[model samples]
Target: MMSTLAERIQKQDQRALAKAITMVDNDHPDKLSLLSEISGQEKKAHFIGLTGSPGAGKSSLVDRLITHIRNMDKTVAVIAVDPTSPFSGGALLGDRFRMHKHFADPGVFIRSMATRGSLGGLSRSTKDAIRVCDAFGFDYILIETVGVGQSELDIMKVADTTALVLTPNSGDVLQIFKAGIMEIADVFVINKADLPGVQKLKTQLKEFLHIADPKSWQPPIVETISTEHKGIEAFFEACEAHKKFLNETDAGKQKRKEQLTYEVYELMREELWKDVERFIGDDPSKEIALQKENDPYQLAKEWLSEWREKGGGS
Candidate 1:
């Protein structure tokens, strides 16, 4: 049954892909076992992350990049993470609407995820969705996240390469530097290059790169008017160069290993929290402490004791 579902995924069946992703996202005990059985057998895919300030034309750039990847006869999967409404717990789903050109294409799979208050700016489901894409046999998987402060930095953990997008005249180039985005970016893109101050922004970025002297490989800056599909080839070339750099650097291998370790610990933490909640039932002692203005650390210790007593630690 798993093999059949996996085959359906490779055939680009949208329903199968969606279901498979949900299975992974749920992270149920049985599902985890199944995932382990099939994990190493899945084909590897190129993972790319795109992020920028809101209104930086990230969606448009992704649309154009998808076209470029398709032109290479490669299948693409896009996970576009949008902000959720705090009250409603729902996303606008606007990113999928922007990439309408690929709506009917089986070769392109696009999914919109709600950030769901994940601290690092990505949805908890984002990694699982990417795994589904990888298992589905996509040649390239692109992750697009809402560009808010330090949230965009989370993309570096998930993507093999990250592109920090900025508009030519948004004055965001300096913000990127201040936010420490410069350190995480494998490539920088000045999107909306047709706008005024394109040259100025490009010059500023070049100077910043020179000062940073980014170790062995310097991040390349590419200009793109994504709506017009201009300079996309150059952007792809930069992505390829970054990939080559990763292959040649020992740092890249260590980085990936650390990322995997983090993911494992993250998963374990979530599971342990769930176990605690389940042990305490609806009226958890931790929740009661929050109402009384009690010490959270003490309450946490109490909960942990209760949890272990209930065999949660087992």
Candidate 2:
């Protein structure tokens, strides 16, 4: 059954692709088997990440980019992450509404995922979802983050080219520097360029770039009016250039290797924490903070010691 699904995904069947992604998102019983079967089938789909502050017009830019990319005869997939609802633990999935024009195009596939309270603005399953899309043979896989703030820098983990969108006079230039966004961004897009302070924002970005003194890739700051369909081509050209730069310098290869390592450790940490949770559940008052609980540090130490002594999971 999993192989059947994998074959359907490889054939670029959108429905099958969506089903497989749902399996990954829900952590379905067969997810690991499905993923293992499809692991090496992901070709070379470019992974582009779009992130910035709320109201930065990231969805708008992405919508326009989809049109541009399709014009060039390429297929695309999007994963738009939205804030999780506290009450229901669900997402409004409003990004679908924003990019609904592409819905009728079979070559374009879009999925909205809830952040589920993830501080990094990406859900745990987002990377896996991208892999699923890649295996399905999309030419590009674009990820739109929840657009929170600095901590959203986790884009570095999954994207080959990350574009940070901002608006004129938004004070995002200063914010990006403070949040170390400058280090992760491959392209800086100043959206709503027709507004006031456009040039001023550009000037500030250039000054920061100079101070950063980048060696291999000096991130290009492009002004865009996404509403008017302006600068979309330029934004894509910059992205293409950056991709080429990464390939030529082999920096992209090294970065991807490092990110894969991070993903491994991240998964291990999650599994270990789940074990800890199970241990606490067996003795809530003593393991967790319930009046008789031990300090968190000591509790962690004891768990580690016991885990080692038991040779893990015994």
Candidate 3:
């Protein structure tokens, strides 16, 4: 059944992709094994991350970019990470509404994910979904995160290029910069270009970019009216240029190596937590109380000593 499902996913079956994503989201025991089996089949897809403050038209910009990419005969996969509702523990999934026109296009695949309390601005299931898309041979994979705050900056680690979308007169540009967005942006986009203060925003961004002293590559600012599908081509061109620049520079390769190293560490941490949970069973209160009562360092030492004595650490 797993192999059949994997085959279906590799064929780009939407239903299969959805099921695979659910398996990962639920953290099924078989998920890791399945991902491992399919790991070798995955291809490298061009990853683009779009982030900004809420109401910056990120969804619309993504919609336009998808349409543009489709017109160029590229198969695109989109992972739209929505803010989870605290009361319901469910995503509103509102980003899909913006890209409704592409619902019937086979060349495009869209999945909405809830951040689900992930501090990094992406859902745990998102990486798996992207892998599935890559295995299915998508030409481009675009990730759109809920425009929250600093956490959205995490997208830089996963995306090949990160585009920070903003709007004219939003008055949040400075705040975003202050929030540490400058370091993650490969391209800065001022959406809703027809609005007043567009040039002022552009000038401000240029000045700020200079002051930020981004490593080697200076981030380019692009203007677009996403709702009208204007300037989208230029935005894509900028992305391509960034990709070229990355391929030509040592910095890009070093960044990729570091990203892989982090991923390995993340995977190891998850595995260790899973094993600990399995050993502790459903009730971890005892362990929690022990750690709270004793110093954390001492508690860790005690646990390690116990595990070692029991031959479990090996």
The most accurate candidate by lDDT is: 2
> Residue 4 of model 3: what lDDT?
75
Rank list by lDDT: 2, 3, 1
* Candidate 2 lowest-lDDT run of ten: 285-294
lDDT of 2 at 312: 65
Candidate 3: regions farther than 4 A off: 1-3, 278-314
Q: Write the per-residue lDDT of candidate 3 for residues 1-314, one digit (tens) a residue.
A: 35577788777787887788889878778887778766775356789999988889998888889989999999899998878866677777655776789988989988887777575366657777777777777899999887777446678878888998988978956786788876788998999999999988888888887787547788889999987889999999999999888889987788778767867787888777766656556447656767668577876677666656766634
TM-score of 2: 0.92
Task: Give residue 66's lDDT in candidate 1 (0 to 100).
Answer: 91
lDDT of 3 at 168: 91
Off by over 4 Å in 2: 1-3, 85-87, 284-289
**What tens digits encode model 2's per-residue C-alpha lDDT throughout 147-239?**
666336778788999998889967857776887776778999999999999988988888888888657788999989999999999999999
Each model's lDDT = 0.80, 0.83, 0.80
Best by TM-score: 2
Per-model TM values vs. the true structure: 0.89, 0.92, 0.88
Report per-prediction Cα RMSD to one decimal: 2.6, 2.1, 2.9
- On the 0 to 100 scale, the lDDT of residue 68 in model 2 is 97
Clashing pairs in 3: none
